[model samples]
Target: MAARAGIASSSTTLSPRVAQGGSNIRGEQRGKKRKSPCLSMPLFRSPLSRMLVSPRIQLPGIRLRSPLVGHRKSPYAERRMLHIDLNMEVEEENADAEERGLDSGIDQVHQENAQNCFDADDDVPVALEDEETGVDPGQENIQPWFDPFFDSDVDDVVPVPQENTRKNVVPDNDKRRAIFDAMLVKARKGYLKGHESKEVSAQFSVPVRTVQRIWKKGKSCLDQGIPVDVESGRSRCGRKKMVVDVSRLEDSSILSRTTIQDVATQLGVSTSKVYRMKKEGAIKRVSSSFDPHLTDQNKIDRLRWCLEMLDPRSVPHNPVFKPLFDYIFIDEKWFNITRKTVRYYVAPTAARCIRTIQNKNFIPKIMILTALARPRFDSDGNCTFDGKIGCFPFVTHTAAKRSSVNRPAGTIEMKPIESITKEVIRNVMIEKVLPAVRAKWPREDAGKPIYIQQDNARPHIAPDDRMFCEAAKQDGFNIKLVCQPANSPDLNVLDLGFFNSIQSIQYKSASTTTEELVAAVDRAFEDYPVRRSNKIFLSLHACMREIIEVLGGNSYDLPHIKKGVLERQGLLPLQLRCNAKSVNAAILSLRTMADT
Candidate 1:
């Protein structure tokens, strides 16, 4: 058959016959050949083959037939394939289960729980067991249990141990006895020990000197081996004599009556001295009518007038003159460049003999000249510039000596006489004085003649100044020069209003150089207020009126007024308002205006 099949297959003549068991046969003998069990039916013939076969591989355990295979079956091979398919299906199912678990977030939850465990272990530094005596001392232990107020509530009722209480103690009775004994000992000590006083007197019940004396006497008693009987000494005391009767000497006896001069002669004293003694507490005045007390309102008025006279702005009509010039005021003081230093005595100790000499800087005295114009009432009764003007010149003469003794001494050096000369005066008048005056009265155009009033100083009517004045007169200027009483700086309103003000302001400042001194003087001048100048004018006018009133309304007598008369009897000197040069410039300008 095989040969026949082979021949047929080769010849391609009849239909080929099939052979089994890996043999190939070709024949169209329908029932002649046997089939191998491994072979299945053709895939095209099966309806389910489409679901089983693909281009790459077939499904596990699925049978597909070749075209040549007929009904073929291998039981063992089928069983083996079935087993492999089942194994692959079981592996795929397990992998699917694992993937579903991951999607449900079970693995992520486990990971976070593991991290929390690690963090909890790291929070505490040490274990509680390690903090106790279980750990060695040298080994580091992080945790410890401590209580701050472990012994706060101990017993107070129990007597404190020796170590718990303070050591020092004092008995009150012993202290009192010791103080008493000290006082007694002090009473026995001599006055020499008492002289050395201390500041402890305020604290002790007894004097500080007594305490010192007690201490000394206690030491002396101890050294001399003497007993101190404190109680017995305190018990002893002394008494003083008392007067019983008192009598007075009677001056009513007619035969014994004597004149004050006769009594003074008998007593070998001056009559005035006798009267002074009688007026004072020393002796009694015999006559009741011998009233030595004189209420000289004129003197008071004169004094008040003098003060008013010092101020150029003050007039007799003003009521403030009595109070304003009652105190010393200095202004417009000038100092020489050379004499700027002042000497003072400094005490090294409280002892008078231990004084140390030193030089302090003080502003030197300067020549201050000023003017006071009387108030001229206008048609409306307002004060105008038509009244008579008074000029006052004050030379602030500082004592060059260490002592500022008011009395004129032969040894005291005076300021230079030529400092108030025509040249200096003219320069100041033009440069500084005129500008200030013009600034003060810019609106006033007084038709009255201009007058320059001054004291009887040589500079007041200097020959050179007189020649200058003549020259000015030739130019048709109505300049009149008036002289104040000799040595009468107090009468000059300029002396008080302008010059005194300057001196007081610059008194404390010491300028070593001429420029510095001049600057100081200028500063002082600037410090004065314009109202002060007005006050000075008022004061001067008031003084003039007072003087006129004192003279029974005739006129003010300049000659009779003393040069050194105080502006107010016990009051301060009047301060000048502006500089001398300013006053002079005002006068000159007024003169020029009058001439015009």
Candidate 2:
């Protein structure tokens, strides 16, 4: 009865499980007599702790044990039971306090501790006491430990720094820029099917923010049956132009401002603005070379020359032009050993090429006399004759006078002719020029007299030079020497572009000696494409029209006729049609002057 009193009095001291109607013993074991209710009750047992029971019933993830069997209860056992009951009462009171604290929503320290205990499974431990020792269980009222975080004043934590890396992205292809935008829209609609932004971005190799923007733009596009398009920006929304009245720059009075910077300063605009104007064809870049100061006699001579070039059969109506294929252009040019400046591409680790010369003026140079006629082509466009008569250099081979690093004494060496006199020109025409004309002239044109055109340089032999006239009547051939107006280089095919073309290729092959320079010039001349030479003749004809338009004044830009396109389409004309009005006006102006 005393044990029964002890068990009943301690009913208020029961744990949460017992107070909530939990039992450790099975229902079948409850009918048997025991020392006290506490004996049948589990000692220091928790729902979290493993419960030992008889083999009759087993709970998953739990340890079961049979009730302890004894003949009688001892005083020590009674005292142990009292101690356990007292601890249970203390724990019950603590649990009630914790619940109250939680309800009040204050005591954040305890709340944080409870949160930690809930987060970590092993935070709150359940200890089982030894039935034999009767040792006092550790702390009964376990108030949750205070969290250090609650005592601080900080709201946000500091984050670790991250490195910002930049990638070198190439510019978008201007040709396919529209296609790229459309692809972006289509990919966003197809690949971003309810997935995260990063997933879609990784799949498409685009930024996450870009993917988000694409999705946001594509939201209502599909539903509304409107095409998804990304607007880059409104046109003309960039930096405003600081200078607007650019027409002032077109005044001829502003001709002194030749460079972009000079024009920019005068107009109070950036140099880039001036460059943009140039790119848009608002202005053009031209060489500052002065035109030939023509006299009255020079103008008359130019007009006469143009009239002679015109076919006499052509009139005011049904005008026909001469083919001019039976004519040859001859000119002299100084071929230098090297250019003043040259550009080369080399590896970063390569050794630099050092070109040493004692003096640029003293550098080796040779005078080359080149002759060419209009190339002949068949109806099928196959070249019949290349019309390259030959190029002769004014050089002679002689034995080396003294020993030098370049060559030993008595070694054969090439030397340039320093003095080019009229006699030298006469001899070259007789010996070298006339022979080439006979050897390469087409058989059909060989029967007709061919005109050799040359510029009016003082060193050039006259048309009636005794030696040249004697050489002209040879092997049943008729060749005449004709001199163009002074300072009218544009009239000849060589000065029109052929010399510049040869120089460009000759400079490509670096030469240190006169011999190498001559060889390089010859190779360049030989390799000069025939079609390019043909184009030069057409350019000569174009220049003649320009001269006639300006009344023999050299103040005209070279006309770009898209000759390459014409040649490719087989529509290139053999001769340009001269404007009949210009022709008649020129003839009338000359005749009127003559009549006066």
Candidate 3:
């Protein structure tokens, strides 16, 4: 105790006070009172003592020399600085112990840590324990290869970057496989540097301890004589996706696939899962427009009708369809007063749109017949005729018997014709349709054999009806009636898409009366563009071609050849060309049906 700083024993051998001094000091400290925080501290903190003492006992100027770490100077001043750092760590540990609740004995916590320091310096004096033990309080990230230093050159300082401290570094399975493969390579080569995992982590941006755990797993497999694999089962990680059997959709019953819920119910899957399958193109929605069940005779009739449409001049060489410019496509449609569903834009605060009527079943509906002809364009691409013959409503004007809110008694109001017999159709065609055709027909096209093509409805007058022929020939016109095949509405341009286009426009506005509905449909009919009508005629030819290919079966989708683009480029053909092979096939099909 009397020796000065340099005079104190600086040898590697134990001093006489080394063994006796710790026991006496502990005895004296046992008599002293300690706070609850000191319970986490080591019972021995001496360089040679295994018992821990309270870190509060500050040795301001203690120093000692040891055989291990002989590079450090054996000065008491340097030793004091190390003890202060250890005391700060003890305080942190005491704080942690308060949080963690040291239920176990304090000696159980630190016996292993205290034993390692004394094994290296059993003879050194009390002051050099912390320099070797490196007691950091609650160090969570302490691991081998943790502080990666990228060494570039021999003399260059290895820079330590905060590379793996980032959170949420979730790598997918493929990336993890690459990492595991690299780890397996380094691990098989003996892991000579011991920081192989850390280097791999730096290369992959994974945490150091994570890489070590991955390697630990692989090494365990190797020890068990199994091929090492650190990567997870790639697709076996999360909840499995539900598999769908497609045969359930092939049922003819509508309940199996009427809606997504129906499909999901039938398939035994969640609706959202079925919807996801649809989004991923595993399934699709289609409105089935099925073909009519055609008998052998009906098929022959349809085949013959399609063959008849092909121009005789081009049959063997080119097989082009008739221009159908002289043909009038007339079809009857029942126009409703208003659509079942409509859309409107209103203020955000406004209430939803609500409509009312006297009786939904009694809602005003009128049957209107539309007549269309292919518009004639001259060589300069100027329209000579508009192609709109007329749109006639099947209603007669009569005096209202009783007054209502809309009209007074004896007012002449147009009423829908209840019975649409052949007489009514003939009278309307003769009185309204032919007059408009004569008024609007191109002068150069007049006196030509203008064929009025109509569907084979029961009420429609036949081609050879004596009354219609007499009326048709009165105006110096060769207007003739030709009936398309029965139950084949696709043969006409009106039913194919023109009527739908007109209905779509008519439904955009609300019409609550028969007269308004008639006017709405008539407006839609007149406003239709002539260029679109020509395109519809082209589409009609396309449909005719498809009919021939299907042998008169209507199981084919309508083909659109970007007719608007061609027309815009002034390449709009008067008639669509048909395949010569298809024409021959149709002829052969008719012959076979005849022979059978």
Model 1, span 194-294: residue lDDT tens = 33334233334445544554455555766688974222233335664332111222434434436776665455567777667677657655443221132
Per-residue alpha-carbon lDDT of candidate 3 for residues 1-596, written as tens digits (9 for 90 to 100): 22322221122232112221222222443224321111112223232221222233212123333234333332322332112233344446445545544323233323433443234646432223332333233322222111011111223434234343459666676777688778877765545255877789999988877677776776688779997666656557688876888677787486568898988888889999888999999999888756668777777788788888899999876999988778898999988887656678899899997787777777678888999888877888778887888888899999999999988999998899978999999999888888888888877767888899998889998899898888888668889999888778888889988999999989876786777788788888888887777788888889888989999887788876888888788787888888888788788877988998
Clashes of each: 55, 5, 6
Q: How does model 1 fare in lDDT?
A: 0.40
Identify the runs in model 3 with alpha carbons over 4 angstroms from their true place: 1-243, 289-293, 343-348, 379-381, 564-574
Each prediction's Cα RMSD? 41.9, 17.3, 14.9
Clashing pairs in 3: 42-52, 43-51, 43-52, 43-53, 44-51, 44-52
In model 2, where do residues sit more than 4 Å from their true spots? 1-243, 250-256, 318-320, 347-352
Best-to-worst order by lDDT is: 3, 2, 1
| lDDT per residue (tens digit) for residues 180-224 in model 2 | 344445564355443556665566565656656655665557568
